[model samples]
Target chain A: MKVRVEVMLKDGVLDPQGEAVRHALGTMGFAGVESVRQGKLIEMDVAEGTTDAEVKAMCERLLANTVIESYRIEM
Target chain B: MKVRVEVMLKDGVLDPQGEAVRHALGTMGFAGVESVRQGKLIEMDVAEGTTDAEVKAMCERLLANTVIESYRIEM
Candidate 1:
């Protein structure tokens, strides 16, 4: 099965890379780009019949920084 | 309007970061993890009723590299 995971910095966390992208956009003449938040997408082809519990556990253990990042898993 | 853009490298492109993460996961004891592809998510709050053309323009101009990356936009 194919699982998709999105991990993003929690609200109030500083995102320097996102800020840099926004600045770059402004400089590149793409105006009115008010706010931008960046995240990561991890696509994995896990074994078939892998339980959601297992996927969630993988996310909690290895996929995300639970302290300052939150993750959503899609099967 | 709130828009989401996902940008990923084209197939056949080398992703060293993803490979590094995969190796790290292996060292951390997460077995049976097959292929992993990493991408970026850009979430932005744009002007109300921004046209799809405008969004596509943004993607082509600033959000992604057309030569090596593909992007999908969602509103």
Candidate 2:
């Protein structure tokens, strides 16, 4: 099975990387870019019988930093 | 308007970061993780009137390295 994990910074967390991108876009003359937030997308190929709980454990254990990021899993 | 851009390495390109993650997962005792690929998700808040062409231009010129990465845009 294929599992996709989308990990994003929790709201209110400072995202220096996203801010940098937004600034770069402004300087590149792409006006009207009000804000930007950057996140990660991890695609995984697992054994057919891999359970959702196992995948969730993967995120909790490594894929995401739960203190500052939230992740969603899609199968 | 909100725009989402997903940028991923082109197939056949080396992804050392993904490999490292996979290795880490293996060592952490998460078996059945056959393969992993990591990508970026960029979310932007743009002016309401921003057109798709402009957004595509952003991806082509700044968001993704066309030589090694492909990007998908969502609204």
Candidate 3:
């Protein structure tokens, strides 16, 4: 079974990388690019029968940085 | 309008950061964590009337690394 996990910086967290990209975009004349934030995505082929709850638990338990990020899963 | 963009490494791309995390998880006794890949997410509060097509254009034109990653948008 294929699964996708997305981890993104929580609101109110500082993202220097994102800011850099935003500035670069502005420099390159990209209008309306107000901000940017970077995060992570993980895709894996888990064993068959892996439950969504279990995958979510994996995210909450290890895959994400909860202090600075939140996660979503697609199964 | 609020939008989310998710950028993830394309399949078969080597992900050193993910490998590192997987190793760490193993060391910390996390079972069943077969693999990991790192990516990025960007969220923006665009002006009202921003269309999904425009948001997608932003992603393809700048926000994502299209060569090694793909993006999805949420409005």
Candidate 4:
């Protein structure tokens, strides 16, 4: 089985790294760039018997900073 | 209408940052750890009338490295 997990900052959280990327892009002549926030994508090929519950556990325990981020998993 | 876009390397693409993050987690005594691939989460709060076509265009023009990545947009 395969699972994809995404972890991102909660709304209102400050994202300095995303801001830096936005600044860099603006300097490159891109327009209407809007806003950018950055997070992480984690993909793994698991045994065919993988369960969503187990994967969610992986997220709560190790994949994200719950104080500042929320995570979702798809299998 | 706000939008969130995620950009990720195609499968088989290397993710040094994710590997580094994984290594750090391992040292922290996290177990049942698996592989991790890193990508980006980009979020924005647009005007009430933002269009998906425009967002897709933005992804094509600037948000993602089409050569090595793919993107998805959510409203």
Candidate 5:
């Protein structure tokens, strides 16, 4: 089965990399770009019937820094 | 309006970062992890009714490296 995990910074956190991208965009004349946030997309080919709980555990353990980020799974 | 762009490396390209993460997972005992690929998730706050063409241009010019990456946009 194919599973995907999208991990993103939680609200109220500062994202320096995202800010750098936004700055570069402004310099490139992509004006009026209000805000930008960058995140991660992890695609996995796991065993068939991998349970949601197992995937959640993976996120909790290694896939995300839950202290500063949040993640969601799709199958 | 909110928009998202997902960027990923072409299949034939090498991803050192992804390989590093996979190695880390293996050391942490995540067995049976067949394959993993990592990508980027970019979220944006743009003008309402931003055209698809505009977003596509953004991907081509900045969000993705067209030589080695492909991107998908969602609004």
Candidate 6:
């Protein structure tokens, strides 16, 4: 099975990297870039029998920092 | 308008970060992880009239390293 995990910073969290990109865009003359938030996309190939629970466990254990980020799983 | 840019290393390109994550998962006892690829997701809030061409330009010029990475834009 193929699973995709998107891990993003929770609302209200500061994202320096995103800010940097936004600043760079402004300097490059791409105006009207109101906001930017950067996140991670992890695509995994797992054994056929791997359950969604196991994938969620992986996210909880290592893929995402639960305190500051939230993850969405797509199968 | 909201735009999402997904930047991923092209196939045949080595992804050291993904390899490290796989190794870590193995150490953490999550078996059956056949393969893993890590990528970037950048979300942007841009002006209502921003054109797709402009966004593509952003990806080509700065958001993605076209030599080794490919990017997808979603609006």
In angstroms and one decimal each, the interface RMSD of every candidate reads 1.3, 0.6, 2.7, 3.3, 1.0, 0.5
Give residue B63's lDDT in candidate 4 (0 to 100). Answer: 81
Please provide, for model 5 over B4-32, each residue's C-alpha lDDT reduced to its tens digit, 9 standing for 90 to 100: 99999999899887787778777887666
- The TM-score values for the models, in the order shown, are 0.91, 0.98, 0.72, 0.69, 0.94, 0.99
- How well is each residue in B26-56 modelled by candidate 1, as lDDT tens digits? 7877677777889999998777867898889
For model 6, residues A13-48, the per-residue Cα lDDT tens digits are 999999999999999999999999999999999999
Model 4: CA > 4 A from native? A21-35, B18-35
**lDDT, model 6, position A67:** 99
Clash pairs, candidate 4, are B1-B47, B1-B48
Interface RMSD of candidate 2?
Answer: 0.6
Error of 3 at B74 (Å): 3.8
Which stretches of candidate 6 lie above 4 Å from their native place?
none
Best by lDDT: 6
Show the colliding residue pairs in model 6.
Answer: none
C-alpha lDDT (0 to 100) for residue B22 of candidate 3:
74
- Window of ten residues with lowest summed lDDT in model 5 chain A: A24-33
Write down the TM-score for model 4: 0.69
lDDT of 4: 0.76
Which candidate, 1 or 5, would have the higher DockQ against the true structure?
5
Better of 1 and 4 by TM-score: 1
Q: lDDT of each prediction vs. the true structure?
A: 0.86, 0.95, 0.77, 0.76, 0.89, 0.96
Q: Residue B30 CA error for candidate 4 (Å)?
A: 8.4
Minimal lDDT window, size 10, model 2 chain B? B28-37
**Would candidate 4 be rated incorrect, acceptable, medium or high by CAPRI criteria?**
acceptable
Candidate 1 Cα misplacement greater than 4 A, ranges: none
lDDT of 3 by residue, A14-44 (tens): 9888788778767766567677777777776
Q: C-alpha displacement of A63 in model 5, angstroms?
A: 1.0
Instruction: Kindly list the per-residue Cα lDDT of model 2 for residues B4-71, writing each as its tens digit.
Output: 99999999998999999999999999898988999999999999999999999999999999999999
Candidate 1 vs candidate 2: which has greater lDDT? 2
